[model samples]
Target: MMIKQVFAILAVFLLFVFPSASLKNLTYQETDKVALNVSASDPDKDAFSIRYGSPLDGNGQWQTAYGDAGVYRLNITVSDGDLSDSEEVRLIINRKEEPPMVTSLKPSTDALSVTEGRMLSFSIAATDLNKDAPRLCLVPGRPERFWGEGFFLRSRLR
Candidate 1:
């Protein structure tokens, strides 16, 4: 009886102290799938998985598909897989794109202006969604690492 009691106490202690630690809630951005830039994050996550459910067409869960674009309910699940504690997040899949780019980059007529007692600030305007998002090289004749992105352009005045 004494041995059993001791074991029970240890078990209880472990259950309380080192319980199967895991994440609980996961969430998706509302702007996700709106511009087709769905992103997700989990607080105590260990792994990630995307399970595609039936679309408006009422088909089976789509784990993988191609060229299919519409309103689709996506069930994104993240799990520790050790404690069975996982989270599910819904995603509304929508694909967005711009027209083809067949033109070259245009040069800014405005030259670099450096002023004393003031910062040399300038704005850039571009049409490419990916390039103008501060990721691509914004400034002309500037280092690739020195570029800032904006909604319609990247603001890098160097």
Candidate 2:
């Protein structure tokens, strides 16, 4: 009877000490490489097999794919042979914003000032890594065109 009571108390202690698996929330950018390792615990010191569901592809520590830009609900399941548990992790993948590059601006530094009635020529060379070519417009912020006498000339690269 004493041994049974001791075993019950020990079982309760173990239950309190050893908890189930826990997954930490992850946040990453689309350009960054993502590899999330599962954290788990068991009373018997059992080895856990972890796998990710949804956007994350494949199993293993560094073999997961997280390239898409969105909020992904990653359900990671960990199994310790006999017992299995699942945990949900919110994986946020933010899109990478790359600034457009103005390779060269014509009407170079040498010719900075503009004349009154003379023909003024200006050209801009720009490129964007995300898009095929950088968008150009006459206005600084808005997309408007410059019209002359019977000719439409705007701030764009030809």
Candidate 3:
């Protein structure tokens, strides 16, 4: 009967001395640097071994890329030989926005004068570093007669 009581007490003690792990979800933009360190606690001060189930360097650093915009599941485990704890963290990567750049504008000068009932020609070129499509449109409330052929703009003044 005494041995049974001692065993019960030891069970409760072991339960209170177990190790635990904690981690939080993270969010970042593309091309941003990421660094994360696992968090764990052990009452017995035991040495812990950490394992990452995702693509993280030894120092828990990752350099995000342009095409890496999405949600990632990070599985981390902390173990002290006999006991182990694990945590699942979500890492979100967002795409960065960049404005389109005008590469060239025909009739280099900003303004030009054309006689009435005459034809005028111009062109505009632009590029987007993010591989997005570039659009060209006339300003609203402008009194002009023009048609676009790709990036080329041809106009006739009445």
Candidate 4:
């Protein structure tokens, strides 16, 4: 009789002592910092451990997401010593966008004497925070006459 009662209690424990875990997907920028709040519950109302990683070893924390730009799969596991459950989320880090910056511009000649067939040179220094390529062009005359390097008419400027 005691054995039968023990088996019944064991079956109840097996049916109701498992744990459940859940996580939320997140998005971030390369230079962004964030924190995560994890959720877990056990049917037995037992104290569980929260884990974030593959194999769910319960070791992870939110901090900064700098220099790491890509998609990352994160796993969270909740364990109650006897039973365990797991959840997963995707964290996407997008590249940051920044406008191009011009630091300095210097002319090759301090005094300009323009004549026919005379070539003028200018030194330009610029940088793009997003590491994007930048181009330089010289525009002359009226605003309507402004054109890019390939389309600019040197003869008109002369």
Compare the candidates by TM-score and give the number of the best one.
3
Task: Report the candidate with higher lDDT, 3 versus 4.
Answer: 3
- C-alpha lDDT of residue 5 in model 3: 12
lDDT of 2 by residue, 1-158 (tens): 22111110111111112222233445566455555544556656656566678666563222223235677676667676665766676666666656666687775553234466887677778865444456765443322332333333233333
Tens-digit per-residue lDDT, 1-158, candidate 4: 22111111101011211212223446666555444445555655677676667312333434433346676787666677766666666666677766566566554332434466877555667666555665655545434433333233222110
Residue-level lDDT of model 3, residues 24-65, one tens digit each, is: 456677777766655666566667777766766765667877
Off by over 4 Å in 4: 1-24, 54-61, 99-158
Residue-level lDDT for 153 in candidate 1: 30
Please give me the total number of clashing residue pairs in predicted model 4.
1
Which candidate, 1 or 4, has the higher lDDT? 4
Stretches of model 3 off by over 4 angstroms after superposition: 1-23, 99-158
lDDT of each: 0.30, 0.50, 0.58, 0.49
* TM-score ranking from best candidate downward: 3, 4, 2, 1
- Model 2, backbone clash pairs (residues 3+ apart or across chains), number: 0
Each prediction's RMSD to truth: 17.7, 11.1, 11.8, 11.9
